[model samples]
Target: MNTIVSTYNLSKYFNGICRVNEVNLTVYEGDIYGFLGPNGAGKSTTLKMLLGLIKPTKGNMVIFSKNFNKNRQLILSQTGSLIESPSYYEHLTGLENMRILQRLRNVSNKKVQEALHIVRLEKQQNKLVKHYSLGMKQRLGIAMALINFPKLLILDEPTNGLDPNGIREIRELIKSLPQRYGITVLISTHLLSEIEQIATSVGIINDGNLLFQGSMEQLKAKNKAYISIKTQDNNLAKKILLTEGYKFKQNNDRLIFEDLTDSHIAYLNKLFIGQSIDVIRIEEHRKSLEDIFLELTGKERSL
Candidate 1:
């Protein structure tokens, strides 16, 4: 778990406002680190600084133990990134674009072919990039990133415009990168389920501050056992459930219990029956990544 990247008091300011505060973080080897936040939460800004696309107004940034300013070429050679929407030469064939990128990086032609194969774009190598579908274009962008055979891959919303099938394909591809190619990944996205499915660890940010950072199991453990109790008298069930010292919230016609042990739930069932409440159903709910995000980020939607 050696550090692949580290930041000390990193801050990015635009027009005298700090978009990225004095944030410190570390990324370990072979990790699929999820950077989660809302649309304007400085996630992309922080990544730009990490990739040296934008300079930090304060503090220092390091990649693979090399300071970004002094050793950028050395560090960037082993790093690949696709930030926001990737643009490619529309008229150039996929293979031609790859060849151009390889020549620019001084990577070999064989490496170019290998990268195309890795992203499953070899079959369409002769097709012009503009003719490719949204998913195909995204795959080609990924192949371009892989051409360098980077030790670290940084992607900003890698699956943004992908279909469900496209999303699953990229999901599988990303999950295989660390173990198969010995590459570490830093991915940012607003999609919680995508991160939950693939990321080994996560860092949640809001208003330029780190809200939570840990393994998936640790984040899931933050909330107590969730139970969904459905009854015809929804209001009564909610009132009774809350009165019994069980913290609960209302979801449609159901009462969502935040913390309730088995015995307490059983007693609740008995009490509801005695009170002439017809119980429709009682089921335990699994707290999803969205639930964890909302809990950590204060249960509010922010633009």
Candidate 2:
């Protein structure tokens, strides 16, 4: 796949404080790239630099294989963005709002209609923006971005305040964009579960530092699996495991074996039973995306 966007050591500083530090990012054509980080993790700052909304304090960026500084307009022409919140003329009808944006982008009215339809807002296109729900407004923001048929879409926290159903709608819309419109997307969010489901690749950032960046499969592969065994006599189980040279850790009433395989589990179960340890339960567990996120970013909340 061709790299549609690439940043080399991109850095952004505010008042002598590093908001984005030596960050490198890659987004390929036809990819749904998830930019994930906790709150204040430089996600927005990096995106601002990428969109030319702000200048980078250090390093540089390349979009469509052209230098960002020299080709700002050319790069932005092919990119559509909805950073932070969606803005609209609340009194104007959705169709009217779209028409205004269409005029600004010099795109055809047909493109406006097509964008509204893509976001599933065609039925409500004539309704006043003030009557639209928050979710609808967000969808409309995306519609505005799509009015010009941009090759790349950058959305920051697009699902910030939607209900579950609204989130699902936006999620499905974003997932389909790359294939349906042939547009690459760079979406930043604190929602790890959403990323795990829809993103082809992920980049994790924390405190202005890039901790992890890779395909979803590669990220999941980093989620370590373990055999968790509970027993009637935990102390006895631990003693047996130790004597048998099985490496493990104890958590409350359970023992966690990180390097255990299926065979090891079976053998351990049999051995415990033979030693009268009275196994209560044994199950395999793997870290969820949220678990991995917390571990990597060292943050408790999803923000």
Give per-model CA RMSD.
Answer: 4.0, 2.0
Q: How many clashes show up per model?
A: 0, 1
For model 1, how does the per-residue alpha-carbon lDDT over 184-206 read when each residue is reduced to its tens digit? 99999877888889998888988
Residue 20 shift from truth in candidate 2, angstroms: 0.8
What overall lDDT, based on C-alpha atoms, would model 2 receive against the true structure?
A: 0.92
Per-residue accuracy of model 2 over 1-303 as CA lDDT, tens digit each: 899999999999889999899999999999999999988999999999999899999998999999999999999998999999988899999999999888889998789989999999999999999999999999999999899989999999999999999999999999999988899999999888888888999999999999999999999898888888999999988888889898888888889889787888899889999988888999888988788888999897564
**Top lDDT hit:** 2
Candidate of highest TM-score:
2
Error of 2 at 260 (Å): 2.2
What TM-score, computed on C-alpha atoms, does each candidate reach?
A: 0.83, 0.92
As a whole number from 0 to 100, the lDDT of residue 232 in candidate 1 is 79
Write down the lDDT of every candidate, Cα atoms only.
0.87, 0.92
